[model samples]
Target: MRSEFERRHPGVRIQIENIPGEGQYVPKLLMMFVAKKAPDVMHLDASYASVFIDNDLLLDLTPEIKSDDSFRLDDYFTNVVDVARRGDKLFAIPLDFTPIVLYYNKRLFDEAKVAYPAKGWNCDDFLAKAKALTIDNHKEPGKKQYGMHFINWMPLWIPWVWTEGGDVLSPDGRHAEGYFDSDKTIRAVEFLASLITKYHVAPTHSEAAAAGVDLFRAGRAAMHIAGHWMIIDYRSDGIDFGVAMLPTNAASPKTVVYESGLAINRSTKKRELAWEYVKFMTSAEVQKVRVSGGLAISAQKEVAQYYASDEQERTFLNAVEFASGPWGARVEPYAVVEDLGREMMEDIVNGTPVPDAVHKTCRLIDLELSQQ
Candidate 1:
């Protein structure tokens, strides 16, 4: 990224700062902001973008994007633009999006001789294939292979609900109103839980982390439900795998995708300069480079075309077309809603009934939204 910046603008200099992980990103950035030494530009999760924007810390890039006659906003994906929206205002433009994909060990499938999931395949196929890959502890006790592994995170689970034609919040985003009470939501949670409880095809969060992706890397689990970020890790391990679209019920085939984008610090004196850098970062040319380098899935249609040469890349891009909104799905008071959802998810995964967990989460979400 720094090289690209330097090459493009000879007179300008670039400095790249490395942050440890997603967990520490915000608090550290917030400290920088408090010290009035925030970077000219920074990448932020769409979920947490509102925090900086709400505090008037983000520069409104609308004028720069509009005034620049060369900027064509239509080139980017609609969902990317939609996610960056803050109450009808455009504060930032998306650089890339991370779409969820179901990765399976092709070698394991070949060994088990189970069929691969095609583009139009549904959850029924997923279950059948997973079962075929799963070996019962008592029967095939020699091998400790499971069918699949989920992150046990809500971001990963949201798609299951969406596939069942359910969401976390109401249309108006005013209150949760028990969206989880829907049969669709219940069924989705049940299906996910059954992989562990009934089929023995998946492990709980603790077990998976202790084992790590080594289970999948060693072809233990036939399939893994994960995001694009796993590409680097899997690639480094030199495993033979195939990325497939996230499975869904035929009735509602839209998969769920999560994303984040870059926002310029409003307090920066070089607001115009920051916008220019942001514009360049999200442009098709730059985005294409980023995507081709396996950095991210660019939001621009033209940039997204860069992934066409690779089969898994192509699979992920195609999956985005059927993608649904993020887990919380609402824009306002995102942190509160996300925390509430996370707590409920942990409760249900730890053995609480789905109905009780859903009800509790919905009530908490309602209260949070009301406070907002």
Candidate 2:
């Protein structure tokens, strides 16, 4: 891609600067800003866009987009593009997106004589199948197979709370006090932990560590909660998989839409060059190349429709309307909130009482928010 971009513009090179780790990215980017050495173009992730949007680190692309006759903002998913927008001002062009969903192994379901999971299945239905599938092979006690896979990732599990009418932060993204510790949220957290501890349908953290392989990817788990990105891994492993919406007890199902985009650094001296690069990267032609590998559903609707070859891809598209952008897009200090939430979940999984963990985590989150 970099080579192609350089080929189009003579003597102008695109220097790719990578931060290497998610933990080190923001800090290093900030240091670059202080040193007046930030790149002309940056790959923007909507999951933590607030860290840039709130600081005015990105240029508003609205004018550039409007002036360019060949491009239209509506070409990409509106909800995704709006993640980096502050009112009428736009900052980024979406590259691709994915919504968290339930991924089930068809082979496991068939072998166990269990039915495939459907979109509208509730938590109760999910639990019943999980329990049945977990203990289906009664003849062999030595070989173990799990029904689902659970991880300590807060982003991955946040949808479980949402499906139960719960959330971690208050409206307007200012607080986490009452919201994080609310009864619904507490109940949701407890239910997730019970899958590992009480029902034994999902592997515990230690078990996953001992296994040294992703249970779902290894085909030892029947159902796993994940996003579209897993399609690449599953396809490579030659596993037959299907995607389904997260189950719900609330009025409607809920999940998070994570997106990535390209933005021009506000301080870039070569603004037009950067804008051209952004436009090229987000074009349908480029998206077709990127989407071919099943990494994510394309942000470009046309490209997305063109590449949605099967039911799993179609299911992911059906989820876009109901999916909400991650709170990190709105909340500036969300990385801190994510860490606190992960700690709370880990505590519950390790035997701390759910209420106690919720209360403790919420208080700590409130303290941190107050500092901000």
Candidate 3:
């Protein structure tokens, strides 16, 4: 990509700084920003865009987008573009995105004599299949198998709340008081918890750790909920797995998405050059290369066609249709809210009553929101 860009514009050099890990990526970028030495263009997670936007650290690209007749923002997914925008102002342009999907082991389903899940399966179907596929160690003495595997990650279960017609915070992103503790949210949380406690279909954190981080790859879990990033690893491990959309609820079918976009630094003197770089990076040619290489779902719908050759890829593309960014991504001080959410999940897994945990989490989130 760098070579291609350089060839297109003689004497123009693009310096790339590769951040090795997610742990220190943002902090280092923040340090650069504070020192007024930030890059002309930087890649940012859609979830973290709010943090930079709140600080007025990113350049607003709305006028540039509107004036560039050759650049059609409408070519990208609406939700993806919307997430990168604060009101009508564009802060960035999404490069790629991923949505959570249900990944199941074909062999496990065959062994259990259960039918494979289809694209539009509902919560009831998921529960019934999970219960059927689970093999208690007591039943066979040596054999160990679980129907599903889930972790404390918000993206894994937060979609359940959305499908149940509940949200983590109010639409205005002001408070979490009523939404987090709503009946629908409580039911969604309980349902996820019951997969471990009541149905015994999922492994606890300790049990999962003992088995390994990739339980589905180890053949210990039949179904796993994850994103497109797992595709390369699963394929490399030779797991006979298939992808399906997340189970639907009575209200709707929904899934949470993670995306990254390229934004210009507000302080950059080379604003036009930065916009050109962003445009080139998110172009169909670049996206097609990235998506076909199994890096991520392309931000451009036309580029998505490059990944439709296989069933699993097609399933992932289908999932993009219903995917929505998490509310936390749009809220200010998002890291604080996300940290509290992780703590709330830990409390729930530790056997705190769902309502109690929800109430406590709501109060904490509200406190943080008030500070913002």
Candidate 4:
């Protein structure tokens, strides 16, 4: 990737540094910033942008975007653009959007005599099909099958909260709104839990990791809710499954999305060059490489559509329309917000009330934002 990037632009050196996904990135960037030696242009995960932007370490490229003839603002999805915008100002341009979808085992559906999920299917439809796919051990003691396999984690389940008409924050971002304790939120959480306690369509969290995707690979589970990143892995496994849009309540929006992009370092001397590199990265050329290469959902509308030429990719693309940024989706203090989500997920897995969990998370973030 670096070789190709460098080949495209002579005299421009590109260095690829590997780092762990979670906490490692923030401290590393912070140390570099302290030394005033942060990279001119680099790709960062969505979660770490808050710290960098908060410290005034990222360049403001809004004017450049507005004035540059070569940089077309209308080429990408508005949701992606909104994600990179904090306080009505652009900090970065989204390189890709991550949409979570439902992957169903065709063979399992056939065995259970359940129909495939159509694109606009609703939550009731999902529940009915899930129940149909669920197999009780009493009928087949040696071979136990579940209708669904859930992560017991919120990242995997956030869509349902949205589908139930709940959200993480108010439009103004002043207070916790729909997501934590709303009726819709409770309904979503209960529905998710029913897969285990009531319907018996899923395994416990521990059971899932020990088993991994084997259950789906072996036709033991009817469906799995996952991000677009797993398409290649599943394709490699050679499973006879199909991808579909996540089922939503009739009253709710029909989509969910997670996006990440590139921001220029404000502290760098070469701000114009840095912006150029970033501009190029989100442009159609590199976006094609990213999407077609199965790396991510490209921010470019054309590139995203091109990647969706395949059936599986089509399902992923259709869901992008209904996408929402994570709570810390655009803000610079995303790490702190993400940390709150992580803690809330832990509480959910530990049997805490969903409202309480979300409330606690909200309080923590509110405190952090106050401190900041």
TM-scores, all candidates, are: 0.87, 0.95, 0.95, 0.88
In order, candidate lDDTs are: 0.76, 0.88, 0.84, 0.73
Question: Candidate 2, which segments miss by more than 4 Å at Cα?
Answer: 136-142
- Deviation from native of the Cα of residue 15 in model 2, angstroms: 1.7
Best by lDDT: 2
lDDT of 2 at 331: 85
Better by lDDT, candidate 3 or 2? 2
lDDT pick, better of 3 and 4: 3
**Candidate 3 RMSD to the real structure:** 1.8
Clashing pairs in 2: none
Cα deviation at 77, candidate 4, in Å, is 1.8
Candidate 2, residues 4-29, lDDT tens digits: the string is 98999989898888789757888888
lDDT of 1 by residue, 143-256 (tens): 578888666667776777787777777776666775766777778877888777767788766767766555787767889878887888788888788998767775546766
- Model 4 lDDT tens row, 261-368: 888777777777777778878889878876775757898988888767778888777677677666555455655565576666656666887667666777776666
RMSD of each: 2.9, 1.7, 1.8, 2.9
What does the lDDT read for residue 77 in candidate 3? Answer: 83
* Candidate structures ordered by TM-score, highest first: 2, 3, 4, 1
Clash count for each candidate, listed in order shown: 0, 0, 0, 10
